[model samples]
Target chain A: MIVAAAKPWEEIMASLHGMHKVLVVGCGGCVAVCLAGGEKEAGIMASTLRMQRKLQGEPVETEEITLTRQCDPEYVRELGKKLEGVDGILSLACGVGVQVIAEHYPNIWVAPALNTKFAGATLEHGSWEERCGLCGDCVLGQTGGICPIIRCAKSLLNGPCGGSQDGKCEVKPNECAWNLIYERMGRLGRLNQLLEVAEAKDWSQGRDGGPRRVVREDVKLDD
Target chain B: MSNRDFAPKIVAFCCYYCAYSAADLAGSLRLQYPPTVRLIEQPCSGKIDIRLLLQAFEAGADGVYVAGCLEGDCHFLQGNIRAKKRVNAAKKILDKIGVGGERLEMFNLSGSMGPRFAAIATEMTERILRLGPSPLSTADKGEEGKAE
Candidate 1:
């Protein structure tokens, strides 16, 4: 899931300085699952903004709404009816969700309330770590299911690089991904497979090429 | 309002297993305490969240405090501990928004501590009195130096 964190209060306030009425939108997608830009967080942000403004003697108004998934056009469309009298929008979704709303409403001012972090998973309650680099390639079949592209500090395909010490990554406090892969492969009696040197990864499949998109004629609906 | 005439509104969230019972005991004993505090009973101090604490201030509370069971004596094992962390989080937020974190606090005491309960009420009232009304409260009265 995509994990995100709320931006500083001062930053958010500064962006909406001239707005009298604002609509705070929450996404019920990856951000909701990670506990960042969910409905409850959106409500809290709106309340905090109003209270801060009231204290400042300006007294701004704020309304809260949570979309099923802000990344989807159908849910983003739901925001159209609520935009009446709203001078600004504070989207509590990930970057993708924010862009979708901005793309839909070209006239309304849109601001993001979160800093999209990474494709990650919750390691524990209130703790998240990046798990996928989104390199646009899969190598888990050869690496014992451990994603070296993200888990390893360096995206080394064949590794246990010199920085690996005592099964820990010297660059981080985490257990070295290469070490874990080595152990798992050994247990599977597939250690012999590691003898082959891997070729360089294809950079074109990733962001190295411009923005990427997918098209599936089978799933497309006639306009 | 003048300092002497100002009556700060203090909200106290009391856990039923401890602080609430202590307040009840204080009432039965006819102990004297400030009238500034308004009590709201909760199933456990753990039920308290950052939103509730902030809402109290947003509703014009001059000061707010959470009274939970003594450390290691919570009825639900860790409710008081959780409440303590939340209080700290809310305090940081209050400070950030210029509301003064000193306006909010958390205390731990057993259900048998009636005198202690009265002491806390007196302490919180005095502290709030020294701090004066919250910026939100002052803003409501349309006073100057609102919340710069």
Candidate 2:
């Protein structure tokens, strides 16, 4: 799931400076699952914004809404009816959700209240860690299910690099991903595979392809 | 913001298992405490979210508190601990935004602590009396800072 953190309160307040009426939209998607921009959190943000505006002697009128999935056009369209008197929109969703809303309503000012962090998993309550780098390819079959592209500091295919010390990464005190991979592979009696010659990953499958899009013709309806 | 007879309004979110019973015990014991406090009962202190505290101040509460079971004594295991963490987190924002973080607090006690409950009420009332009304409240002097 995509994890996000709210932008600094000062930054949000500054962006909403002169706005009179704004709608705070929360997404019941990845963000809500990650506890960043759920309906409850969006209400908290709206209330904080209202108080800040009031403190400045310019109270803002904020309405809160939570859509099923802001990334989907069907749910983003729900804001059409809500945009009537709204001067701006403060979205508490992931970047994709925020962008979708902004693209749908080109006339209204749309601002993201969250800094979308990464493709990650909830490690525990109130904590999440980046798990997938979204390299447009999967190599978990070879890496013992650990993502070297994201977990390893250097993204090294054949790692446990020179900086690995006592099973810890040199970049931080965290356990080295390569070490964990080695242990898991060792347990599976597949450690020999880690020494196999590896080819450079296809960069085009990633950002180098310049904003790639998927055409799932099977799922699309004819226009 | 200072007045000789200014009585600050305090909104206390009391957990039913502990703080609520503690308040009730205080009453049974004929304790004398300030009447400025308004207690709202909750199943667990963990249910007291940040918005509830902020709304209390928004609604003219001079001070807000979450009275939960003593640490490790919450009805829902870690509810009191969670509430304490949330209160601390909200306090930072309140302090940053000039609402005076000291106005908001989290108190922990057991159901049998009747005297402690009354003492906390008096302590909170006196502290609030010193701090005066919340600036966010829309009372006469705070009307200039109205939200609507």
Candidate 3:
């Protein structure tokens, strides 16, 4: 899932200056679970903006809406009827969801409220750490379950570089990904798999190459 | 007469099973506490959203306090825990927006703490008196120097 954080307030204020009727749209997928741009966050942002606008004497009208998944066109289509009279949309979804909104509603101005960070998971409450790079490869079979592509500073495939110290990554004080994988594999009596090296990741599937697409003819919209 | 004219408006959200019972106990005991504290009974502390807390401030509450069950003794198991998180988050937001986070508080007490509830009400009312009035109220007073 894509991880993101809200943009700074100054930038948000700048984007919403002339807009009177604004819709703050929230995505209920990854961003919601991570507590970055969920329904609750959307409500908070809308309330804050309304208060700030009132203080500025502009008195903007703000409405909040949350979708099941913003990345899907089917979910976004439900917003068409509610888009009437809305000057613009402030999307709390990831970059993909924002672009999908823009592509779907070309007439309305859509702005992103979150800066998409990475594919990650919540380490604990209010704390999230990057886990996978989606580098078009899966090397977890040989390296236990940890992905060095994101956890390691250098994205090393063979083993930890000279940067590991005391079973921790030298770049950070956190536990070394390789060390964790090695220990897990050792415990499982699969230490011999460590001898096998992972190949270089193919870069085509990630965001850099182009927009990725998946098609399912059986689940067509008309059907 | 001027000294006796001050009346601080307080909003108390009492969770069921504990704090609500405590308030009931206070009433049953005929405890002499200020009537300024308006009780808003809720089914569980978890149901008290952050918006309601902010709304209390917006509605001219001099102080707001959430009374919930003891930390691990929530009737819904973790309702008080969720309420505590929201209270902490609301406090941070209040502080950042120059609202003085001291105006908001969260207290945990069992159903038997009628005296404790009375003490909290008195303590909160006194604290707000020392702080004088909310900055929002001061803004209404047209005092520019003390607006913050």
Rank order (by DockQ, best first): 2, 1, 3
Could you tell me which 10 consecutive residues in candidate 1 chain A have the lowest summed lDDT? Answer: A202-211
Residue pairs that clash (backbone atoms under 3 angstroms), model 2:
none
What TM-score, to 2 decimal places, does chain A of model 3 have? 0.93
Candidate 3 residue lDDT tens string, A1-223: 7889989876887887799999999999999988878899898778767655644546578888999989999999988988889999999999989999999999999988999999998888888889888776676666788888888888888888887888999888888888888889899999888887666677676669676777899886784
Candidate 2, B7-110: lDDT as tens digits: 78899999999989999999999999999999999999999888888888777788999999999887789999999988998888788777889999999999
Task: Please give each candidate's TM-score.
Answer: 0.94, 0.95, 0.84
Kindly report which residue stretches of model 3 are placed more than 4 angstroms away from their true locations once superposed.
A197-199, A215-223, B1-8, B58-62, B70-78, B126-148
Model 1 misplaced stretches (Cα beyond 4 Å): B143-148
Query: What lDDT score belongs to each candidate, Candidate 1 first?
Result: 0.92, 0.90, 0.84
Model 1: CAPRI class: medium
Range of the 10 consecutive residues with the lowest summed lDDT in candidate 3 chain B: B138-147
Task: Please tell me which model should have the higher lDDT, number 1 or number 3.
Answer: 1
Give the DockQ-based CAPRI class for model 2: medium
Best by DockQ: 2
**What DockQ, on C-alphas, does every prediction get?**
0.49, 0.53, 0.20
Q: Judging by DockQ, tell me the better candidate of 2 and 3.
A: 2
DockQ of 1: 0.49
